[model samples]
Structures are given as structure tokens and as C-alpha cells.
Target: MIHTNTAMKTQYHPISILFHWLVVVLLIAAFVVIELKGQFPKGSEARELTKTIHGFIGQIIFVIMVLRLFARILFGAPEPKNPSQALAMLSKVMHWLLYAILLIAPIFGILYFQYAGKEIHFFGFTWPQLVTPDPVMKKSVENIHELLGNSLYFLIGIHALAALWHHYFLKDDVLTRILPKMKGVRN
Candidate 1:
């Protein structure tokens, strides 16, 4: 049986770890495609193709994130140890913020897609439209959606930096608590 104790164990399930890392990689790829590839000439096939690819990957992340959230509540997360009250609250609030953004960003993106009179397809499977086209609404939604995504990058950066801080400065088990278990460690 996988033990849930924080003092002894240093990680979550292997499956959860797998999903976490996969999402990280996918998020990086999606971000790069959207923000870093804008130097290419307009009307280029490559630019359009990258946008489609980014959209498809974003859709995939949306599905996985919902699954991850469900798993968190169903299985329950490990408890923290002797954390300062403020730090504990910070953790909880930051986590919920991340979850809220993850859920909202994709929905907004899909709404923008429909509003702009485009069909959203996930790996060639057509996703149903959530809203009809309206040029003004489309522009507004798309702009805010893009802004939220940019905001996510900074939030994610803070999360990463916090993890590193716990790992190196505090020398706490916070980082290890989510790391993959070593072969000899009891699960």
C-alpha cells in the first residue's frame, strides 16, 4: 500500500508525477509556440500551422488539468509539516489560483475560437461551439484570453521559484514531497 505520511515519504504516486512532468513540458511547448514565434512573417504557412498546433496542445492540457484536479480531491494531498500559518494559507491560495486559471484559460480560448467564426478541432475531432460569432465580442474575449495566458506565465514562474526556495534554502522536504520516489524508498 502507498503510504500517505509526509514525514516518511517524499513524493506522490508515480502516475501523478508522470502527469505533472508531462503537463510542464506541454505547457512550455504551448507557451513557446504562442509567444516566442511571432518574429516570422505574417501570412506564412508555418505561423498559421504553429498556431493550430498550440491550440490543439492547449486543449489537451485543459483535459489533463481537470483530471489532475479530480485526482487531487479524490485521493487527497499529503499534509504539510509545521508550516507557518501564513505560508500555509499562501500555498492553498496559490494552488487554487493556479487551478482557476488552468480551467478558465482554455474555456476562454475556446470561446474566442467560436466567437471568431472558427471551428475548434482536437486532433481532427471537432469540438462543439460554445458561442456564436460576434466580431466585437470575439476581439474582446480573445484579447482577455491572451492576457490571462501571459499572466499565467508569471504565476507559474513564482511557483517554480518557490519550489526551488523550499528545496535549497529551507532544506525542507517540500520539493521531495512531489518528486518521484527512489527505488529503495518505501512508497
Candidate 2:
């Protein structure tokens, strides 16, 4: 078994906490921009601009995820305090699912753009097209990307609810483990 100093550590590393919340904010911005795009007419500049903004946010999220993964490996997470084996297993699976979605969704988004014969202009840089333009492939990839994007809503909802449940009902540090520690205040 992998051993950890669970009693000594009450929270995740500060960097991990930052990365977790940063990704949450970025995801929210990405979803908002895409939805906001609908307010503009199709093919209009405002719509296209919102799409570009969404793409940028996705790219940023992908980069942060890579860094976050490294940070997770370098500074391991604190173990849950006195969790049931089943609950611990469920938490592990949920976390893996969340990580998979965050990483894969962005890749499919990039492929969707490439298959549609469009380059992703992320901030001031352009991402080269990885695949030759193909209308059929574009449609297929777009569907997969959208499906994964939609899945985020359900996964994130369950995650948030689980955290709240642990905090309020179960009265555990499961939620505070990933929350930022305030100065002059205890978690």
C-alpha cells in the first residue's frame, strides 16, 4: 500500500488548491462564452469572437491541466479523514472521471477545429491544424466534443454536491482539503 502522512496534512498543497479553483473558473468562462455566442446571429462577428474566446479558454484549461497533473504528482493529495472504503473508492473514481473529461474534452475541441479547416487562435498564438479538413470528420468530432462538454455539467454538479454533503452532513475535511486556507483563520 502507498503510505501517506494523512494525520499531518489537513489540506492539499497551496498550488493544488489554486489550480483546482482556477480550472473551475476557466470552465465557467468557457461555458459562458459559448452560450453567449448564441445571442449573436450565426456567422456574425460577435458570435465568431465568442467562439474564439471559448477556444482560448479551452486551450488555457488544457495547459493548466498539464501543470496541475505534474503538481499533483509532485505534491500528493491529503487522504480523507476516516472515510469508509466504499466512499473512498467512489471518490477516487469520481476524481479520475473528472480529470479524464477535463483533458479529453479539450483535445476533441482542438480536433473539431482542425477537422473543420480552422486553426485555433489562442490568445496571441495560433495552434497549427493537426488534421486535414474533412466535413464528415468535423461533424463526428463536433458531436463527441459537445457530448463531453455536456457531461461536465452532470459531473461537476455531483462533485459539488458531494463536497457539500461531506462538509455539512458527514462533517469531514473532504471539502476543506481542496479549499484554500484563509489567513488568520482555520479551515
| Cα TM-score of candidate 1 | 0.86
**Reference-based lDDT, residue 113, model 2:** 85
TM-score of each: 0.86, 0.91
Best by TM-score: 2
Cα lDDT, all candidates: 0.78, 0.86
Q: What does candidate 1's lDDT look like per residue over 1-187, in tens digits?
A: 3244434444565666666777888889998888745966776888777777887888888888888776665455665532598887787787788888877888888888889888888866897877879999988988888888998899899888888888788878777877777788843
The C-alpha stretches of model 1 lying farther than 4 A from their native spots are 1-10, 184-187
Poorest 10 consecutive residues by lDDT, candidate 2? 1-10
Q: How well does model 1 score by local distance difference test?
A: 0.78
